[model samples]
Target: RLAARSGLSVGRLKISVVTTAKYLIPSLLGEFCQAYPNIEPEFQIGNRAEIIQRLKQNLDDLYVFSNPPRELDITTDFLTKNPLVVIAKQGHPLKDKKSILWEELYGERLLMRENGSGTRYAIEAFFKENRIKMQNPITIASNEAIKESVMAGLGIAIISQHALNHMAPGNLIELPVHGFPIPNSWYWVLPKGKHVSNAAMAFREHVTQGLSHKKPNEHA
Candidate 1:
């Protein structure tokens, strides 16, 4: 709860965040809501391009982007380093292996996010750089759909570890991809020269301090 003595907006803080749909749905948003009921957050999950576009339009007080561009006209702060992981159905052929190679995934029926999605871009780049051949993926728009596809043994995918918690037991398995992880940092950005609202600033400080005090395991 916001301190009554603060006399801040204390009722609403419209935070616009751009991160993974997986994180927004069940992890980051949930924790934030539980901690600050007065703060109302609106999220738009998309690729770096979409997030940057929204920032340029002054549509959001804050944006949570992965790998935000250095040349953007915005102020930035680090949130967390998210590592990518490969996901597959349980009892998959590669499950018993300690790790799998990028080449090992060649010819696999991969599930992929739609174009313009940050997750899809990263996965595609990784495969291309390593010359790993993948079959035409069944493209989906949201993380939820992707998760459901993987759970049904439709195809495997590389996604943020945040989604692992929500996977159905004995239905989805995390595949260890070689040369994987491809660590990405979550960042908060604000438009240049624009002063932040009092409520937004309060929530920002709360989140910044909260992140600083977090145990490694909590973020990990």
Candidate 2:
């Protein structure tokens, strides 16, 4: 009886997410909190492998990812589209070129996300399918760090456009590399056959309805 009352009186919504969704989910969560101010919202952010491990252990209420783990028994509800693109510091030689080729990007120094990152996986998949061996690339963990490095002209990187939205205008601009704007989405993920709490279920519905009203090409 007490637990039920607590669930109603002070709902707790726990969420886990890959870094790409880090920029968007918080704003949505903020809106949810206003409607349920007493609700305690907990968040866990990590690379794909770590987040999936927690899901295997049933650690939290919900999980978000851009690249869903294959062959895993999980319930996936598509939340929002996440566009991934290549970006470089403003004023780079390739900055002004509108029509660019993937082959051209190969010769330039590249920066990549750390291991087990969904962004890194997507980048690798692109290279694999094209049969292009990625030249020596620098690996950086933090999304912001990658942007900063690119701004310093350290190296260009493939990053989620969601992260790019938060950067100052003109500081980092998308490079129109071939086959870009890689189609990806943030998913409301759950462990298959596991019990989902009422609060989580409510938030899932909230997210679904909220996204349905959005334009197809809306920025994250």
Candidate 3:
């Protein structure tokens, strides 16, 4: 084990990340792997609760979360901003509206992530602080599914801006709702006092350098 931690080119890297981080982490991991060809990366993707369970068990060398679990004794590093935005299918009536009020969403069908989702938690907190109650929300388990549903014109959803990176140009449009693009960020987490593997450390350094080169808007 000690020998493994001392070498970066030939060891396994176990990384667990939340479902939302799926959009960003894989590409980063791909870059890291390309640079260190022999390093094996075990990437586990799950929703917030599942990832938290893995964190509690200390199951991986690293973990990623948009909203880190508050009760755990873990150390975290900011990876990138994960802004949540409101999106609706193209041609929707509200697409052209400017500075749409939060109240305007009250009548529209809202698509939500399942309970225990970091995005849902953030959105719920925002709604509570604003005294807004979702009239009737459709709970979906994955970000991809929610995006598909939104594109199908089922309803509008609040999702990470990164999720929009690979989307087609006109399938969906971001809503001009006030207080939108809720400010959030992805973090790299590890149990407090945990041993840092060399491969994991290398990946961290790679992410830092990679993100530094990105323009501000490109972060989303």
Which ranges of candidate 1 are over 4 A from the true structure? 1-7, 10-12, 19-40, 45-49, 128-135, 167-170, 209-218
Each prediction's whole-model lDDT (CA): 0.68, 0.80, 0.84
Backbone clash count, each prediction separately:
0, 0, 0
lDDT of 1 at 177: 72
In model 2, the worst 10-residue window by lDDT is 1-10
Give the TM-score (vs. native) of candidate 2.
0.89
State the displacement of the C-alpha of residue 72, model 3, in Å, after optimal TM-score superposition: 1.2
TM-score sort, best first? 3, 2, 1
Candidate of highest lDDT = 3
Model 2 bad stretches (over 4 Å): 1-9, 212-220
TM-score of each: 0.80, 0.89, 0.92
Instruction: Give the Cα error of residue 91 in candidate 2, in Å.
Output: 0.7
- Residue 58 displacement in candidate 3 (angstroms): 0.7
Candidate 3: deviation at residue 23, Å? 0.9
Query: What 10-residue stretch in candidate 1 is worst by lDDT?
Result: 1-10
Residue 92 local lDDT, model 1? 87
